[model samples]
Target chain A: MTAPLLEARGLRVTRIGDAGPLKVLDGADFTLERGEVVDVLGPSGSGKTTLLRALAWMLPDAEGELWLDGSAAAEIGARVWRTRVALAPQRTALFPGTVADNLLAPWRLKVRHDAAGPDSGALRRALDSVGLDDVALDRDAAKLSVGQAARVALVRVGLTRPDVLLLDEPDASLDGDSAAQVASAVARFAETGAVVRVRHQRPDGTATRRERLVAGRIHGVGDCE
Target chain B: MSEAAGVVTIEWPQLLLAAGFMVVVGVISLRLALGLERDLALATARTYVQLFVLGLVLRWMFGIDSPWLVLAILVLMVAAAARTIVRRAPDAPKGMLGSSFVSMALTGFIVTFAVTGLVVQVEPWYRAQYVVPIAGMVLGNSMNGIALALERTFADLDARADELLALVALGASPWEAAAPSVRTALTAALIPTINSMAAAGVVFIPGMMTGQILAGADPMKASAYQIVVMLMVSAATALGSVLAVLLTYHRRFSASGVFIERGLRDDIATARAEE
Candidate 1:
């Protein structure tokens, strides 16, 4: 049998709190396959964001057994692992530049220098796919509205073309139509790649499987209804 | 001691008259309830005592004319400057005394030696009279510059934590992630030195130039020395700021290049507790 696209076992995270070390995630197990979208449901402060950051290797104190395309994360290295498993955090943070500049920001990193950079036409297509067709590429990203910025962020993350997209509430600030566009964007990505989406509200998109995180443990909530 | 060179020496008893001027300022503070009379008196006393001790030490060193003695004095100055820099920047990570000391010692000795050895071309290179004062000046200025850079670096790091994390999430290296904060801190540290260069001899006579003139040196000669002092101070400040940032910026990241916000804070707290 082919290995899953991405897998995590015994994922643990410890963050320093006001009193002492706080155990945020403990022994959380997960798996994703090619062309599958998994929705992670959790209440506030249930370690959903921490789990995604840990999977992306962005948390310094996070430890786990993780594999990507059957290779151990330790063997793959953090830099290469992150390039394959991109994360879109819940809060929208755009670098200081025009929309097009923000979209191409990742390509400028040394780690991404080897990857094929997207052309202008590809950028336009990604924008169109995310319902940002009306927005000008030259517009200052800081001037974009909350919903417009959300779409732009989604498009930015999609342009990187990772094997697994760890999205943290990509539709939190989006309107109904924009939210639908985001769901479609995830669906399109799932057609080729895999997605692990953490959501507080149920999105319009359908997932192949659903799981809820409670107190840092993953509990299966059955397949998509 | 000689008035023929146009030098004016104030008698030792005349300093009591200078003390009268302080009484005027002290009375004003007393009337306004400014609560600065005690600090002012203590500071005045320290100035007198410190200068007297420095004068005795310099006299003794110049008589010995020993390079080892000069080196010892220079090291002592750098150590004191580093301690002051670390103490002034209370918010910076702990155990920075070592880095600051190295930054100050490296830049301080290099710039001072360059000025005295190459520019001034003082005979016997480590002349206590020439080297000690120059080294003190470099350490004094660069100490302030390095402290400012370190403080600004940590402050900007905390303020731009989210932006830094965003870049890290995109596979940015530690240097790439901390680039913005480093740039801002370096700029902040260099501004005072740049402004001093701009204002020298025009807005105000610099301290070194004033001292040379008061010692009966020609105005033109004093101006030349002032120019060299200004340039060397700027160079020392720039080098010290860069070195400080280089040593401390990576403290915000892990060995594998993760931005450890919580870990950094805990480490800082631990350092403080140990202190």
Candidate 2:
């Protein structure tokens, strides 16, 4: 499918513990088409995080060859690679500045900021789309709750309109309604024809594709979708 | 007593007073480490032994002066300070020790020499009396500043790895991503030294001053030395912190500039006092 928007091959993540190298992501391969959501299901200790991170081209320590869109990971600059694939980390990370400050985030960057930053109108539209309004722009990004902040982050990433959104357990910390909101936003992104997102799930939660990670391997890509 | 021997011999009394002060500090500090009493006791003993030994060496080097000996002592002081930083910042990046050593050496030498050679101009430029104390003060304070700075920077990095990763993904340079977080910590950690410098006079007199007065220096002269000491500390603290933090980036992060938590041993409650 047009070489997929994102591709990862032979990805492995390791952490040096007292014992030895603890392999986390072992030989995981994933190809992401435009606007598809590939939920990565795994029990605790599975390599869900490592796999999602690899797809974002942000896993510096993970062993893998990641390609973005049709370009090889090594061939593209980080700014270009990132602009194409944005990661909505499960952890709510708001820039230390104000709400408006975070909304205007890309404007601070020398490379991606110049090309990707939308004007004020564009930013307002993105925030409004994410159910945020002009009032949130002035608030301290650090002060928001997980759900509110996550939505704001979604809006922020949407400003860039990445070709592939790498979301790691994006549904976490949200109430039923917020989870639906987060899911809908993600669904909207996928519908726009971006590449796949390797999403992690809270236990007993539901998604279109249920793939469990056992011993660092994706054992089930079955008909759960 | 002869009229010719009209000297106040309170040497023992004076030394006892200083010993009393040490006891007071030890007693107070013990409370904080009550949970680990054995470790605390050992650390206290080690500190006493180390400081007393340092006192003897300083006494000799300051008196029977040899330039080579003085320089050697200064080098030893820098080395000791670097080692202290390594012990203090166990959780930092791997090259943290070497980074602390080199950067502290560079900054300490520059500031201490500049103050002695140009600012204060001790004629020999390496007088043990001046150089030793200056080295001790500068090296000691700089080492502390670096340790605090390094610890704060890396801890912030650990907690905010996701933020850092996001920034990196956005094509932000590795330095750019880590710099702000590191800078926040570096600035906060430097405040103690800065506060000391700011409060040198009105708030309280420093240890060097109190020591000089007890050793029979004129109060005015002691004050002068202190002013110079505070200046030296200020310069060394800033330079040392900035350099050590900048150099640490190389050791603590992966090729993609990801922070390696195992980069160094920062949680030194283990080394400081074993369970």
Candidate 3:
């Protein structure tokens, strides 16, 4: 395989506890092809979110190196890598603004490429796809319900159109219906070949691969089936 | 006592009439305050009553001519005010309450000494007439300033924490996240004193200068004291406000540099938690 779109190797995370260094993630390796949607399943403390943060070039305290295609995350050029890799946390942290502004915030970031506001047709299509109306674009984002905010967060990231999107438990807070909507948004983004990474806890509280999160550390990549 | 030395026999009748007018102002202010349903009025009246009693005590303190007696009064005033400020700081750490008081009083003293001792150069720095009033003005104003600064600092640190975390996740250091709100709180806490100084004589003559004049100080002397007091307040208010924010922001970030759960939160949680 000629270097996947995103690659992670030798990732480890530990925190100092009363006893000693409590290892959270030990040598987790990950790779993603263009447009692959990988569901990560792990126990509560198996460091799933930590892995995503490490890949995103965040988690300053955690020791990891991420290669976006060929260049190291550190050397990949901050603006370039940021445009390519975006993280949408599960909480849907949207700012205080109109829904349209929330949908277009990443464009304001110097790293973003989508300077032209979401085309009116694309805006309507995206909103309609997510079961929102054109009127929602004019509503104050601060007054949005959690479900609305979650959708708005997805729409904003979609507007950015990153290469590898790290979504840590993106649907954790939503109800069944809201979770389905969020999952649908993720699936649509996945169709465009952006690597979508997600984490979930298993029934037995042990690490399992919902997709390929079980590959390097626990060696259970085929378990998602 | 002699008319020849230009010490004209003081007119007690006129002085009594003047005192009665001041008393009337205080009383009518009290009535208006109550009529307006301002709870601050009762507290203001209570303060007035305390000051009236303080006047009686000071008269005896001056008669004794003992530094120890006068020193005792100053300490009592500082302690009481410090307690009040500390009590007002509901969210401040258990350890900071005493330190906040002592530190604010110390800030006031440093500023007061600079004005009266160095600039104004009263004969003795501790002369009760100058030292007491100057110290009283400095500490009193600073108590308000520091109270606001401290309260705002702690409250801000604990609230708006999501913003702090957002900045952190966005590659800002923890201190950087707190810098915006900390700056905001510090400025808010200092504004009352600053605005009063900025609009002095234009908005309303400061009560201290007016009181000094009514108490028989020369108008020029009263103005001088007022200027010094205002300058000292400006310096002390900044000092107290900065110290307050700096110390409060210290607890906002964790050892791991993460914005801790409640460590940097504002009042939002408490309100929600109460609910």
Best candidate according to DockQ: 1
In candidate 1, which residue pairs clash? none
TM-score of chain B alone in model 2: 0.78
Cα lDDT tens digits for candidate 3, B1-275: 12133223447596566556556666776777745324444655676578779788767666666667656766777787778777888876655656665666678668877877898887755667666777777778777887887788768766765554444443345565577677878888878877888899888878887776656667677688788778887888888667755765665454434555452133323323544
Candidate number with greatest TM-score = 1
lDDT of 3 at B16: 63
In candidate 1, what are the lDDT values of residues A41-106, reduced to their tens digit? 888878899899888987665668899999999999988788899888888878889999989988
Off by over 4 Å in 2: A14-23, A133-135, A175-184, A191-193, A198-225, B1-9, B13-65, B211-219, B261-275
DockQ of 1: 0.50
Q: What local lDDT score does residue B130 receive in model 2, on the 0 to 100 scale?
A: 77
lDDT of 2 by residue, B10-81 (tens): 575785676676666667768676455556557666876898798798788778878899877777777788
**For candidate 1, lDDT tens digit of each residue in B122-187?**
999999999999998888999999999999988887777777777777888989888888899999
Best by lDDT: 1
The reply for model 3, stretches above 4 Å from the true place, is A16-21, A76-83, A107-125, A175-178, A191-193, A199-218, A223-225, B1-158, B167-180, B191-215, B219-224, B235-275
DockQ class, candidate 1: medium
TM-scores of chain A across the candidates, in order, are: 0.95, 0.85, 0.84
Each candidate: chain B TM-score: 0.93, 0.78, 0.73
TM-score of chain A of 2: 0.85
Residues A63-123 of candidate 3 have per-residue lDDT tens digits of 6668877878778754466557776766666665787776665555443444566766777
10 residues in a row with least lDDT, candidate 3 chain B: B263-272
